[model samples]
Target: MTTIAPSRPLTAAGYPRGFKWGVSTSSYQIEGGHDADGRLPSIWDTRCRMQGKIANGDTGDVACDHYHRYPEDIALMKGLGLDVYRFSVAWPRVLPKGKGRVNQKGLDFYDRLIDGVLEAGIEPWLCLYHWDLPQALDDLGGWPARDSAGWFADYAALCCQRYGDRVKHWATFNEFAVFTLFGYCIDWSAPGITDREAHLKAIHHVNLAHGMGVDVIRDLVPGAVVGAVHNRQVVWPEKDTDADRRAAALLDAHWNKAFPDPQLLGHYPDLIAESIAPYVKAGDMAQICRRTDWFGLNHYGPIFAKDDPNATWGFHWGAAPDDADKSDIGWPIWPAAFRDELIGLTKTYKLPIYVTENGMGGNDKVDDKGEVNDATRIRYLTLYTDAMKEAIAAGADVRGYYVWSLLDNFEWGTGYQNRFGLVHVDYETQKRTAKASYAWYRDYIKAARAAE
Candidate 1:
């Protein structure tokens, strides 16, 4: 007795057979009761205490209260006719000290969560780490510390040894670029630091941590499929000038290629070394080169670059030239660039790719009809899917598409202000209302299935 809209009468655009439709979410962003069931403080917990760090002084302490409402959430996913559920496991919850011991209660929660998803007939795509470094680890030098990599490996093994049988799809880390750059260099996120030296050190260690985690998971789960999640900005130049193009190349090296190069090519991007040479150590590159089963790209929008010597990162972002579609988040809705990114990565790495996260954030509210018909979000989803279809037709080995979120939850720093969910969550009442985007997506997938 699942609930969904009637399939629309429309011809389906050809997509690769067996292309998956799934929804994604993260631990800290959605799951509340931060200290419940033996969970301990994470770096995010400490960051939340810093005044002026988050908008509206928001914290994920009670986000969506998913800790108490997961069964209902799973039922909603079943209603969406989703094939997979991509979610993250909070590190501190499992390893309170980040390394020394395991908390049975913490592991029990995910054990139940996975079992529930499986009972709902949804494949579990578990992400090992998603920016929630245990507070104990941060106290021990955080990701910049070489020991943190080993600690992560231990934790990954622990999770796999326990739950690998039920979790078929695994992702090592989600968006290392955003965590390292925004958290360290920009000091905009948790455990904030703005030192260039710390940034480079954290970058190498994060890469090594990902590799070690993958190796551990592979050992524990003999048949588990592994990938690393990344949010890559498809960079574009503002003009045809050589300087602008050069800036775009640099932007791509830092934003898109840095995270994937070592895992796939056994080396960091050349421009990475050139840009951060002063802070690199002798054998850091060798430590980062670990093979992965797949490359997960979490693309949202493209960044237009122009040469700017005075810019903080030696590059500037320009607004999209054309405005055929735009999200309430002010992001351009360009589907063409999405295809280009897939093809670009395919040519560069020649590996299987999955669109791990893609969706639009909007100002959403239920109307008089008790319907959250967010037409703008629906349009964004359609155009983005069209982009994915084009890439598949062009022979890109793209495997699946997981929408950015399952529920409107705590968006970091912005807090609950930015809503990026197919289902809207009223923060006060904790009510789940499916939006127009959700209804449209259900129809789209059903049409695709009917066409098959």
Candidate 2:
């Protein structure tokens, strides 16, 4: 027993009136009907089929089984009393071969999903792309190809025509940098390539896709609240030296400014501007910089960077100090950095921000009495949310907060070793166990709204 403490009473904490709260989950992470109902292979599916790409040989072949059990999961969301539920639509699901032919079976799955989410009294936030690009599209050059933008736009049009009526909260993509950087440069994620040209091309094309997708959604879906989720984390130097400083600055540009800067501000950062210029044709910036409704920030913690001549882009991921505070998954935990990011993000972007994903991974274990009391996760949420409140008080126009996930599904790269969910999922029996943080968030939302 980790010594369960008494639950605290609700307090307003001065959160603004109608500060929305919810949870976020992606398609491949949870929905594991990999081969069912005309669904085809995504880049992730191809990666999983490759040897030694994912940890522990874990494939999302049966991840949390959300495809089969979403109704039960909707009941879970209803029980939580959320204002909205954020999830991504798998591209390969609706467009089995990327584009051209529509898979009505795949389209019908989301129809039922959106209907169930609405019936549960929770608004559905549909994200168009969460990096599960159709493998057929990858076969045709993936995000590195300029045509990928058009492909994504066609996919967006199909989704808008299908479920745009109920899904008013539309996000074009989720964590653009993560998928592009990891997939093309880092070789840690799907479509694992390490070519510099591929990385830059993927970055530009993905941003172009976002803008095109936004245009399609706005044209098709009336009154659509459109945004794109970007994982914006502060980049820290691995050391205090000039080499480390330069590396951190470049990584910062790629991590923070790559997609959002081009998509929102109309230009690439100076660090990679020249390198990416070859791919930029006339008026491409105008096309990439489409107007969006909100900025979806998916932040976790600060990322460390160091100069690496042998690594991609002349820099590689570095390590935090031995004594630095870390999450269960070894990610550095500095809620103050999170607080500062929120404030800076608000000032820089000047858009209503919604934290689409924020949560910590935990080593959740089912107790002997069939309970998962993940106190560590609860503490992480408290710290982050309190930091967010501080940012809100300091004049950040942050409207909503959605936790990273609803269930502990297949964490990319690390597999299921990292569990970032309010509800714990037992991989063995496919059981969903609400952790202590779930109740905490439920009450937190209640109190924030009650204050109004």
Candidate 3:
């Protein structure tokens, strides 16, 4: 593990005043009471049952058991000195059948969770969707269906009426491309299907859903901060040739700009607009473009693109250098690109930004002393966060930064193999052990507050 000392103190003086610092988690990733309290099956639940769908056959059926241990988790956040905690609400939990009938018990769970978050002096940043679509909705054709916009709008309106009074900050969706493209185009995620047309249609519907969600929240919750979290990659071409550059631009249009351009700018990038034109309705763009208060960006590292005429998307991922520093999941660590992405998004969107997710996953283990010494994760956080500070100094209006996770939880297709949390979790016993990175973050937050 490479440890680099901070050139200056890790204090609020290094960042803008009133900057928010926090951690993030999703419902299906951390909240494991899968069958508890009248919750119905989500698409992920169905996908987990399929043979060979998840790594090592591991499922989120009992992941971290956060549903039962949120009090302990909130205490952990309070101890970490977090100003906010960003989390997602499972739609299937509240609306078991996806459309009608409210589950009071499910609503009660989040009611208590938000109350607990406030009781602990941490603001709850709630996200409506985090890829755990209701299986009932999937049965009715899911995002590929044009009616998904109405389904999601109804869900959003219900949530706003139920919990929006207490929760002021809300995000409509998380990583539009990951769920739509990976789920529909590549068959890597839930409701796995391999159809380019479905992928394109899913893109339009999800964007429309986001816009409708914004409208619903505005109408239902007064003074609510509404936005969506997008995972934007700083794409680079494998070679500096015209063809490779064009391929990188095309990949950017599909992967990065497809969702945000429509939401923020009210139109798709010209490269893929015609490809997606067939599914778009007359007033879809009007609904897809809403007044988002902030842009939630989830970035990890840069993606290298290469020209591939034979590829389905006219581009293919190029391999990183063998010697490049990487996380346990083999994602290359490029802090410079992280800084670039922050600045680029700020320049393009011109909205106050929140880095909603950024962290490196590692194969962390508790040593014989019953302590986890994840120096690699600590280093990654320090470098990337410092990069974010640099981006802010370079004129990016970044308002907040949240680590990718709060606990070691089920990592989607990778299952529980990747640990990205400052707090380590023992899967068998459900023990929460704070790693060395946890202490580092605590002290950093303390210093930042003191400096402020």
Candidate 4:
């Protein structure tokens, strides 16, 4: 039922009954048991080893020590009154070498984490992949290899069979385009390579893997509410010049349409179809297009693209206008874009939508008073949530909202320089202090759920 009038501005956060509120965290970003208990290194671990790839010489080596302190983290989730907790299973942790040798201790760790989340009265949403591919898998050609799809399906089968009884919400992958585009087309992320053909192959292969993973989840896990998470946002031209405009259009295809259009609508985006044609076989779309329960969107803000003849695909990341309000990390803060993306996504994809990740990143530090008062993060959350409520009023099927992170852990590339969590973590002592945004989110959840 409609909770607010369509013509009015969003005043109060009165979402539909049963609206879900939660938080998200990834394995490599937070869980720091790298090399403990038969667990092997992921591509991210290898990336950290390279001399200059990570900032401040920071690594996730002991990040938040969430691997050992998940019980404490689960208490934080309970303290927030979360209805759900979204987390990913590190591939290397489960299959130390990507496949063949199953790590029992690795499996057991997730068992305890899942059980703890359940005991805290929160449902578990387990994402199978969150860009931490096993370094061994990268050695075997990573997502560019067609066989990688089979590897992912086997891994999904392992997870589904083990945890399907308790966990019903399964995401095949989180933000396919981000890792593929950044890793292959740019040197921003791991397994960094810059080749057009490699980028195309990675895109097609990852989409194939997602499709195969979905089928495996359905086959192995009964009552699975399966979906694939895509990082979607508006792509704008960096300048008014024709070159930048063309670059932005091409980037829009790669960033927004490449993954979801094929998986959901059964065809590749026009700009990408011809380039990816050489790799696609007959009926491959049918194989990749599996039935999913929801569209998981991880949106932050609009991206601008500039023409760069020397870059892979001849397009590069640009910046927001100088006057634009930005997060402390320089990410643009435009709630209208978030609102429009939601409304547009509902019309285009026609699936129940869950905002799997949305939050601000800051250079947060605990004050001398032993407290973190991140007032800027509170504003970002307030503006974004109000935009979301506006989207719901405009006929969007948005169901749940989970912030980007639950703790200030290791951010990739930027490393520990960026903090995107509501709860501030003192990386030195492993102390978890709830920030001002944490209290804001907790009360926001309470108020959103209590709305009539």
lDDT (C-alpha, whole model) for all candidates = 0.84, 0.89, 0.90, 0.91
Per-residue lDDT over 306-422 for candidate 2, one digit per residue giving the tens place of the 0 to 100 score: 999999888899999999889988998889888888888777787888999999987888898888898888888889988987777777778889998899989988899899988
Ten residues in a row with the worst lDDT in model 2? 1-10
Residue-level lDDT of model 3, residues 29-148, one tens digit each, is: 999999999999999999999999999999888999999999999999999999999999999999998999999999999999999999999999999999999999999999999899
What's model 1's overall lDDT?
Answer: 0.84
Question: Residue-wise lDDT of candidate 4 within 1-452, one digit each (tens)?
Answer: 23322332332565766778899999999999898899899999999999999999899888989999999999999999999999999999989999998999999999999999999999999999999999999999999999999999999999999999999999999999999999999999999988889899999999999999999989988899999888999999989999999999999999999999999999999988999999999889999999999999999999999999998788999888999999999999999999999888888898889999999999898899988999999999989988987788887778899998899999999999899998988888989999999999899888776664
The TM-scores, one per candidate, come to 0.92, 0.97, 0.95, 0.97
Candidate order (TM-score):
4, 2, 3, 1
Off by over 4 Å in 2: 1-12
Candidate 4 Cα errors over 4 Å, as ranges: 1-12
Span of 10 residues, lowest total lDDT, candidate 3:
1-10
* Candidate 1: stretches off by over 4 Å: 1-13, 237-247, 274-287, 306-312, 316-324
Error of 4 at 437 (Å): 0.6
Top of the candidates by lDDT: 4
Sort by lDDT, top down from the best: 4, 3, 2, 1
TM-score quality measure for candidate 2: 0.97
